[model samples]
Target chain A: MKKRAQEVERALDVLLPLPEGPEKRLIEAMRYAVLGGGKRLRGFLVMEVASLFSVAPACAARVAASVEMLHAYSLVHDDLPAMDDDDLRRGQPSCHKAFDEATAILAGDALLTRAFEVLVDVDTHSDSQARCELVAALGAASGARGMVGGQMIDMLSEGQDLSGAEVTRLQALKTGRLIQYSAEAGAILGRAPSHQRHLIAAFGRDLGAAFQIADDILDTEGTAEEIGKTAGKDEAAGKATMVSIMGLEQARAHASMLAEQAANYLSSFGEKAANLVALTDFVVSRRS
Target chain B: MKKRAQEVERALDVLLPLPEGPEKRLIEAMRYAVLGGGKRLRGFLVMEVASLFSVAPACAARVAASVEMLHAYSLVHDDLPAMDDDDLRRGQPSCHKAFDEATAILAGDALLTRAFEVLVDVDTHSDSQARCELVAALGAASGARGMVGGQMIDMLSEGQDLSGAEVTRLQALKTGRLIQYSAEAGAILGRAPSHQRHLIAAFGRDLGAAFQIADDILDTEGTAEEIGKTAGKDEAAGKATMVSIMGLEQARAHASMLAEQAANYLSSFGEKAANLVALTDFVVSRRS
Candidate 1:
């Protein structure tokens, strides 16, 4: 896991070079928001799943980096004063707190734009069709009907009495879709059969649900130092989360069940998906 | 011009249909930001230039609508309190004003994401390569080194001394790149020869420069109602502009000269380029 994280970090460094210009600060902030942080779980999924189909390491790495860029952009915007107002991220100050709100906003926009730019580059994939598919999938995963839409629901659901199913759907859209996309991207890049692609996508969906529950658990129980962000934020803000709807013990049990189901989907790949299967356990059980 | 604008408006309405969901407000904000208003100058360029190559009207309109979506996203973000802090856009309350800050941010993000989504769709072009090219070009024009980078420079350069050349470069990156991409997109959609594409690109570059100067002049001379946005905002914010560096008369003459140079680049197409050539004059001379 650490090795994959380091690989994506190196890829990101090359993809986002700082230039000498008046707008250099904008690039700097983008770099600041993206580099040297996070578990790189989503990136790991891309590379590992791509490896199953023997996709080129460099190509997989580029897609992984692009996913990371998109994820970073979401975090930057979500941390804004008008959004979650987060002050910390990945054990450091959030983008807006480190720079300023305007720079943070522009940096997020640029990062999102740059993510698509990277995907469509010849270096990412020689086949333009595959590249176009990646762009389309990524856009659907991150756009209004996907991640941003999930975020809007999240903001609006604050202090509202949401049912368990509603909370699950919100989490699925907010975080599950991108994680699912990261896994499915490997299949798209590798040109896997539709059946195999569906298998990986299913795994991603269950794993994403499990991961979000684990995150909520961490928010409720872990210290800020351990979680690398402000703890108890959801509870304080009265946000509708699985933990809020399902109670702590029930949420933990639900996450475990989802993780197990997620692992079961990878059985079709047999030994080729061993790492991915193991990741399901790590996702739900990790302390941070 | 009015007809092309109406065509794009219809295309946008179809592209951004309101969905019945908890996130409907998010889509509503997106529709509000994009559906009505603006000159649709960028969209018109796409359709007009595509018409020169006899591309299908439906395909041209789709591309044009995508460009308008991208343009609207930029405006939405620019009007944020942390950014330009404008309360009006296209003579209506800005996204943040009509909605709220968080919703506005997400709406801008969704619009930008949807723009790429539309480009990658098969409806935009039957050729996957062309779709990929559009994604790459639009990304390059709107990313950190382009539009967002220009916004950063604009924010940082307030009250600072800037030379004519510096201001010109800033405007080129901020607004010119996207406009240039819009014009170039028509050739891309038509699969025009490399030489023809270069010719149109040159025309776009000159025209974009002229358009910015003309816009600055309007800010100086036009009323808020006429411009559909706050008048004299550049000067009020101590922003560096061509009009600030060059005297008003010199700036007007410079815009006219650039417009003429722009029209000259289209001479290679002979009478087929008549509308585009006429557009140069309308761009520079329009009251708003």
Candidate 2:
């Protein structure tokens, strides 16, 4: 996972080389948001899944970078005062704090736009059909019915008591869509059969749910230094989360069950799915 | 132009069909922002140039709508409190004012994402290569090197004196890139030769500059009622504009020269370029 994250970091540098000019600040902000930190879990997922299909590392690298860029944009926006309002991210000042709000917003916008550009480039995929499919799929994952929609639901549901199912649906929309896309990108790139793709997608969905539950658990139990962000924000904000709805113990059990179910979907890949299965365990068991 | 605008409007509706459930608010905000008002000059440029290539209206319409959505997203973000901070847009409350800040942000994000999706959809183009080209061009026009960069320059340069050359470069980045892409979309769709695409791009460049100059002029001369947006905002904000850099008469002359130069580039198409020629004149002459 660390090796894949490093590969993605290098690919991102090559893809977004610094330019000389006044507009260079925009690129700087973009680089800061993307290159600074994070587990690069989404990028890792893209590479791991692509490895299953024996896709070239170069091809998978760009796809992974694209997902990382998209994830970075979401975090930048989510950290804005209008959204989650976090001042710290990955133990550093968030994008809005490092720069001004306007610059941060434009940086996020550029990153998102650049992600699609990266996916559609000839270096990413030789076939136009594959490129278009990737673009369309990423759009569905990031747009109204995906990440943004989930964000809207999350903000709206704040302060209002939400049932366990409602919280699950909220998390599904907010984070699940992009997580699923990250895992499914490999199959799209590899031209996997429908059944195999379905299995991979299901693995992603279960893994994503487990991942969010684990995150909620961390919010309640971890320290700010360990989490690299303010701890207990969800509870302080009275935001609906799996832990809040299911209770901490139940949420942990549910997450473990989901991790197992996520691994079960990978049985088709047999022993080759070891990395993904390990990833599922890592997601649920991470301390931060 | 009015006829083309209406066609673009209908295409937007078709491209972004209404959805039921929680995400409907997002769709509504998108529709309200895109459908409520605008001259649809970008869409008109797309269809008019595509007409020269004999590309089907159906194909051209989707491209036009995509540009419109992109433009609408810029407007929505530009109007946010942290940016331009305008409450009014096209005689209506801006998205944030109408739908709240979080929803407005999501709607803008969705619109931007949807633009790429619209371009790549099979219905937009039977040729995957054409769709890929369209996606790439739009991405280039909208990303850090283009519109967003221009916006960043605009904000940073606020209240600071700038030379005419600096202002031109700023506007070119802020708005010229997408305007250029709108014209280039036709050539990509029609599979025009390289030199022809360059000609169309140059025409878009000149026309976009002239259109911006005319807009600046209207900002000085027109009322809010006439313009459908706040009048005199440029002066009030103390922002540098074409009028601010060049004296008013010189600015007008520059715009007129650009309009003529823009028309000259379309001469390769002769009579087929008639609408484009007329558009250059309209761009400089329109009150709104």
Candidate 3:
């Protein structure tokens, strides 16, 4: 919707078709899955962080591309019949709905595998160690203890009462981990020290928590038309969402608190963190 | 299994569990998918190549473990009902049959993502440039243009007439790419030069093709009991295979010929390649 968002969108348009051959059709399907409009929040975070340090525009674009692929993968599987079972994503038929279920499965697999391919073969990033760190961060966040684990917990807790802390832990793993990696991955490539890494990761954690809480609030407070996909699906599934456990008012306040915490982390970076600052606000108040 | 195979197997034995925790179940499932029995060819390739250049044992084995994880993910997805529809794999019910379809899908996803994590986290390898090369090779082989593209072609070509060249191209991408990767990946980690790298890859190409030809022969010639899975399901599915395109006798001759080509590549390495030599013969003759 915004200019930077437009830039990320255009960048993806060109990068997604880089591979050729029998992969041509499948890669087309995968690129469509990614370019199928979203907030592009994760890609924004990567580009914003890179812009802060004046890192080369081209290298930053590569990181933005990598994170988007990871995000696309999460969405595809999350909407699968066995997982969240939604029929729509980003205002159109979901991947599994648009494509066959098996194709959707393979599409997600292809995207996830291809993300690392972008990093390893990156002609622009000559620093292999930095590239390796980015790969590790991305992998850890998406692996067993990250998004997939969070999904499993989400599934298991559907009919059970989970404690507030349990819900946060699960949400952090499922949503926060990748968000954390988004920022950390950018910083790793930029050669941030240990403390700077922690600082950025802290920002991602708070931003992700606020993002999820805002989602919970929107699920209860927003209309289905406004949200694009199914709203209140969490309640229908008996999910232990913030809105369900703590009520709408508390969830809204909690998310606001997390948003402010996210902004606080960027204070160390000064005016250069303008995009990051706007991002925290976007995380808290966006409808979709 | 021999001693080193047992060593890698033992690491896998302990690596598969996560105890009782938020991420435990998903992690356990991923471990179970890999820990199941199969020929240790991929792992052996990593270790043997690492051994050739005297890389540390853990460095070599870590890459081996990641290769096994990727290999296992392929097996899991290939056995799904929409794919090959095979009921058994490696003498056990397929992951989908043993676990639910959803778990099998996620297990494959987790394993694929975790392979890159293992690559980055392990500290035994010394060459930053070479490590990146290793990562590139693995990603190329595992992603759409290599394994997944080949898989898509494999799926699309079902019930179609195929020529010998088409079958070779399919098999080269689907099977040979990763096997070629297994050898080159290890040699890269050991800091082998471009020429040396080319040699190992050449060896892998010949050996992997030989192995696949033997597999075609097995489909026509071996019993299910000996192969540990369904035999000749390819022809029943009306998918053109090497044995179908060329007669079984010709297929057997092709396999033996490929094995000789594989052996020829290894003569450059002198006697240090004994295990690789033995492995070539082993691959051609393997019943299971």
Candidate 4:
């Protein structure tokens, strides 16, 4: 994960350099939000899933980078004062806090557009069909039917009681779809068989669900020092989450079961799936 | 123009229906921002340019709708309190005013993502290569290097003195590139020859410049009722523009000259370019 994160960082640095103009702040905010970032778990998923098919590292890296860009754009917008109003992200000032709201908004917009630009570029894949497929999947994962829809629900549901099923659907769209795309993208890149692609996508779906449950768990149980950003936010906001509906112990148990199921979904590949299996375990175990 | 605008409105209505769920707000804001207004100049450019090559109207309409989606997203963001802070758009409340700020932001984000989604879909073009090319072109025109970059400059240069050349470069990136893409998209859809594509793109470049200049003139001379939004905003914001840099008379002359130059770029196409030629004239003459 560390190595893959570094590779993604380098790729982003190359992909988004500071232009020699006043608009340099846009690139700066984009880099600030994207680089020196999160666990790069999404990028790791793409690379590991692709590695199962021995997909070219460079090709996988670009795909990984594109997902990371999309993820970062989401984070930027999620932190906006009008959104979650976050001031810190990954223990640093959020993009809006680091560079004013307008620049952050534009930076997020640019990064989102850049993600598709990177995906469609010939450098990412030689086949235009593969490129278009990636573009289509990312759109499906991130647009209104997916992440954006999930976010809208998250906002509207605040302080409102939500059942476990509703929250599950919310989390599934909000973050799971992107995570699923991240995991399944490598198969598309490698032209893995449809059965293999479905297996990988299923693993991603379970893992992503577990990942969100873990996040809720951390938000409920961890401190700011451990989790970064403000902890206890979900509860304070009366946000409905796995932890809120299922309780901590049940959520923890559910996450453990999901992690195991996620790993089992990858079992078809046998030993080649070791890294992914471990990553699944890591998702539930993560503190931040 | 009215006919083309109506087609775009219908296309958007079909493209962005209010889904049953909490996300309906996001779609509401998207529809409210996109439908029922605007000159549809970009869509007109697209259809007219495509018509020159005898491209199918359905295919061209989709491309036009995609470009308009992008334009609407930009307008939504630009009206944010953190950005331009305008309360009015197209004679109606801005997205943030009509819907709360968070919904507006997500709506804009969704629209931007939707633009690429629309372009990459197979319905837009049977050839994956053509769809990918459209995706790439839209990204190039609207991402950090284009509209977003221009917006960044606009924000940074606010309240600061900017030369005429700097303002031109800013406008070119901000609006010119998308207009260029709007004109060039039909070529991509029809797989026009390289020389032909360049000709259309150049015409778009000149027309886009003239279009921005017309916007500045409208801001300077028209009333809010006449222009459908707050007029004289440029001078009020102390925003640097062609009109500010070149004076009203010179700016008008420059725009007139550009309309001619833009039309001349299509001279090779002769009678086939009649719609495009008239559209350039309409761009400069439109009040809203």
lDDT of each: 0.94, 0.91, 0.82, 0.91
| Candidate 4 local lDDT, residue A69 | 95
Regions of candidate 3 where Cα sits further than 4 Å from its true position: A18-22, A123-125
What DockQ does model 2 achieve? 0.86
lDDT of 4 at A229: 83
State which candidate, 2 or 4, has the greater TM-score. Answer: 4
Write one digit per residue (lDDT tens) for candidate 2, span B87-133: 98999999999998777877888999999999999364458888998
DockQ of each: 0.94, 0.86, 0.71, 0.92
Q: Write the per-residue lDDT of candidate 1 for residues B1-288, one digit (tens) a residue.
A: 999999999999999888998989999999999985888999999999999899998999999999999999999999999999999888999999999999999999999999999998846445888998999999999999899999999999999999988999999999999999999999999899999999999999999999999999999999999999999999999988888888899999999999999999998899988989999999998998
Ranking by TM-score: 1, 4, 2, 3
Which candidate comes out best when scored by lDDT?
1
Q: What tens digits encode model 3's per-residue C-alpha lDDT throughout A104-194?
A: 7777888898888787765545778788778878888888878888888888788799989999999998899988887877787677778
User: What TM-score did chain B of candidate 1 earn?
Assistant: 0.98
Relative to the unseen true structure, what is the C-alpha lDDT of residue A39 in candidate 2, on a scale of 0 to 100? 96
Instruction: Quote the positional error of residue A219 for candidate 3 in Å.
Output: 2.2
Give native contacts recovered, as a fraction, per prediction: 0.93, 0.82, 0.72, 0.93
TM-score of chain B taken alone, every candidate:
0.98, 0.98, 0.95, 0.97
Q: Each model's TM-score? A: 0.99, 0.98, 0.96, 0.99
CAPRI quality of model 2: high
